[model samples]
Structure formats: structure tokens, C-alpha cells
Target: MKKSIYRLIKFSILPLLFICYAIYITGKNTGDFYKRFSSPQQNSLILGSSRAASMNPEIIDQIIHSKYPNAKLYNYAFTWAHSPYGPKYLESIEKKIKPDTKDGVFIVTVEPTALMVDKNKPDDPQYYTENDKSVAKTSMVATNPNLEYLLESYDFSITNEFNKKIRPEKNPMIEVSVLDNGQVHGKVIKRFSTEKRKEVNAEKMAELKNRINELKISPTRLEYLSKTIDFLKQHGKVMVVRMPVSKVPYDIENSAVADFDKIILDITESKKVPYINYNNYPNNYQWVDEVHLEPEFMDKFSAVIAKDLVH
Candidate 1:
């Protein structure tokens, strides 16, 4: 009986330990979202969708340190599907930020897509897409080796993550790395040819069109955006920014929501926070797609934002 019990314990405990270790290592090395979850609570944060994920927190810190000393900015931005202004994201943000934080900087990036929800059930929290995602479901966001996120939210296998870290793909189409400081660095291994660029643009346009049909601007989400700003106000300054995009998608967004800028301006005015619309800036920077800024231009963009914040 004693021998059988010992064998059972060995079999179960050993594999469990191995899995825990593998998960820890995987969280440390691979998965873009994993590193964000494993890190400690941030003093300052950059919040938005994938468009804002590539905003380099380190670059922003270096440039803005003189004005706001020791301000550690973490990019808590996820994707359009996961981080739209809603209760789920607000809950996650609340968990990620330190409770006692005062005089912290918060950058909230705005776009039409993020403020949209399913047209059929715009008011129902139960049917929200983000509720099914890690950002909404994960209870603990500031813990090292967040086991809950690794087990539930991590999409890739542990073996795959290990393979990526050990033997990275050579000349891959794209390479993405999530830094300890919570910045997501995505490198385009090679620039797209003219034909390839056209193809990508067409696909993105179609996706945007489909979303326009399926979703609508949510009053609930807009309210949450206000709540997010109000909550961040207690900590410190909150800057609302509208990131720049290429002409094609920009036209579509503006056409979809004619009053988008006015809506954002009203909110900013009411909240008494600065609103910077980079869309009004000269479109000289490169883009990976119609919406996302190219990684090469991220530092320049971050520097511009940092300077704008202080001046």
C-alpha cells in the first residue's frame, strides 16, 4: 500500500513540477502577453489596442524622465478584440495598476474600432467578445509567472514557446518580442513588395468593412472610457491620443464615424485632460499595415509623444 502510494505521488507530482517550470520559462521568454502578466504593477501605463502595443515604453521613459522622474511606463495595451473600453478591460486595468499610485502618467489611445461593439447585443456584457479573453478573465495581472494566464490565456503550446526561444526562425516574415518593461517590439523581417503591400491593404480594408457592418459605436464603451480617465486622474495626468494611420483606412474610419473626433474632444474637455490627435500630423512615417505603425518608426513616434507630453 505504501509503495503504491509513493509511486502515485511520484507520477503526479513530477509532471506537475515539470509543467510549472516549463510555464515559468515560457512566460519569461516567449508569448507577447505572458511577459506583461508576469511583471510587477506599473507606475505609469500606455493603454489601447494592438495599434498602441508597439509604442515603446522605454523610449517614452528616456525622453520624459526629466519632466516626470522615475516614471516607469508599461504598455498594457492588448488587441482590438481584447481591450476595447469596457468593464472587462477596466477591471483588468484596475488590477494591473498599483492601488496607492499617485502622480503616475497614463496614455489612453483612442480609435473608432475600440469603441465599437456587436450591433445585436451592444448593451449585454455577457455577449462581449473580450469577456472570453485573458485580459478580461485573468484575475491576477501583477504576479510573476502568472499561472492562471499561462494555463488559460496563452494560445501557444509550451513546447512551441520553448522552440521559438531556443531555435528562432531564420528570416521569418515577422518577429515579435515582448520586453520586460512591457513594450511589444514587432519587427518586419522584410518590407513587403508593391504587390504584397496591395494584397495586405486589401485584406485589411475588407476586415474593416466587415467590422463596420457587424459592430456599432457603443455608448457603454464610451462611458467606460470616461470612467478609465476618471480612475487614472486619481493617480496623475492622463493624455488621450488618437494615433495616426494611412490615408485609406483613415478615410474609412472617418466615414464610419463622422463625429468621432467631436465625441473624443467633448470627453477630453469634460475630463480636463489633454487630447493629442496624431492623425492631424504629417503622414511621413511608415506603416506595417493601414493601421499599425512600422516598428522602425516606433522610436520616432515615441519621442514625439514624450516631447509633446512635457511641452
Candidate 2:
């Protein structure tokens, strides 16, 4: 009996220690937003999906600083499902803005899908979708990190950790390193030929075009977005923008959601917020994928955004 008890303790303790070690290594790279939640001190915030993640806050600030010398921009963007309607956006707002934050600028970039029901997944239990729940969990951990967060950081395989240590690749999914100003350098790791991607997307457009009413802009999202705008307005000016994508994907988006721009315009006009659709801008920019901007173009894009904000 003593031998049996000793064996149990030996087995349990070893596994526990291993798990603790895994968590420690995995937790090392929790991304930038998680790091910022501890003390989210900033003057300007750029909020949106993956496209917004590609923005360089440092470049945007440099371009705008001449006009507002003290201005700062923090890119607080996550990937899919981090929509304005979601709890992540609200939680981030709560974390980033304090009662004393009297003056700031809130730039919100919108993707059509952000307002449309995904129809591909369960919608209840807010911020608990598979893709976003872990991210939201990770970000919330920043407020008060604990053992659970440590566990959440653990990957089942140590090989993944080993590979990273041996050859650290900037996580193609989320920026591995974030600057103090919350600038994330998300890179475009892969791309498909524009014509080929467009051809593939055309079929997707057909499916969506038929489901317009079923997948129409979510009223619930609009309501929450308005709430976010109202909250930001009390603290600072608000700007709504639709970032640029390639022409083919842009056309497909239009086909998928009719009058999408009109709806956005109505909302912005009602709220008296400035709205810019960079799609309408000259097609001088380049794309890494059908939807994301190339890194080289970000500086020029940031300059354009700065000019728009200043005006």
C-alpha cells in the first residue's frame, strides 16, 4: 500500500511539473494587446479586424504628429470574430479608456462580415466562439493573470514550443512582438494570384448574394456599434473607415452585401461621424492577399489616414 501511494505521488507530481513548464514557455508570447491591458495608457486607438492589425501605429503617429504633436495611436486589432458587436471590443474599450481620458481619437475600421451574421457558427454565449474565445480569454488574462491563463498558454505538444525556440517565426497569425505604443507588425505570409483568388471568390459571392436577407447586416451589431461610438464620443472624436482590399474581392464583397456602403454611410451620417471607404481611393496601393495590405504600402496608407484625420 505504501508503494502504491508513492507511485501515485511520483506520477502526478511529474506530470504537474511538466504542465507548469509548458505553460511557462507558451505564455511567453501572449501577443501585444494582452500586454497592454495591464495599463492601457494611450491617446488614440485603432480598432478592427486583421486588416487593422497590419497597420503600423508608429508610422501613423509620425505622419499625424505634425498636426497633433502629442497624439499617439495604438493598434488594438485582433483577427476574425473580434467584431464591434462582440464582448472583446467592449472589454478592450473598458480596459483602454479611463474616466480621466478626456481627449482622444477612436478609429474603427469595419469589414462587411463584421456586421453580417456568419451563419457558419453558434452565436450565443457572447465572446465564446471557438476562434475568438481563446483570444478573448488570453486578453482578459492580462487584467489579472492566473494559473488558468498559464494553463491556457500550454500547447499539447512540446514539439511546437521546441520548433519556435529553434526557429522563431513571427507568428503569421498574430504579431509576436508589439511595441509599447501597441504597434503590431503583422506580416502577410502567403498570397494567391489575384485572378485565381478572384475566380474562387466569385463562387462565394454567388452563395452569399442569394442569402442577403438571411445574412443581412445584423441589427444587434449595429446597436452595439452605436453604443461603442457613443462611449467613445464622450472621450474623443470618432472616425469610421472601411479599409482597402483588392478590386476583385471588393467587388465580391459588394455582390455579397448589397448597399453595404449605403448602410455604413447612413450610420455615420446619423452619428455625425466621419467615414472613409479607402476602396474609393485611387487604386495605387498593392495587396498581399485579396483582403490585406502589403507591409510596404502601410506607410503610405498611414500617411493617407493621417491626412484624413487631420482634415
The residue-by-residue lDDT of candidate 2 on 117-220, one tens digit each, is 65654454342342344445555423423444334643345334545677877545433555556555554465557787677667655654454434545666
Q: Which stretches of candidate 1 lie over 4 Å from their true place?
A: 1-17, 165-171
Question: Best candidate per TM-score, number?
Answer: 1
Among all windows of 10 consecutive residues in model 2, the one with the lowest summed lDDT is 125-134
Every candidate's lDDT: 0.87, 0.65
**Which digits, one per residue and each the tens of the lDDT, describe model 1 over residues 38-84?**
88888899999999998988889888888889678999999999999
Show model 2 residue runs off by greater than 4 Å.
Answer: 1-41, 119-132, 135-150, 153-163, 167-177, 187-214
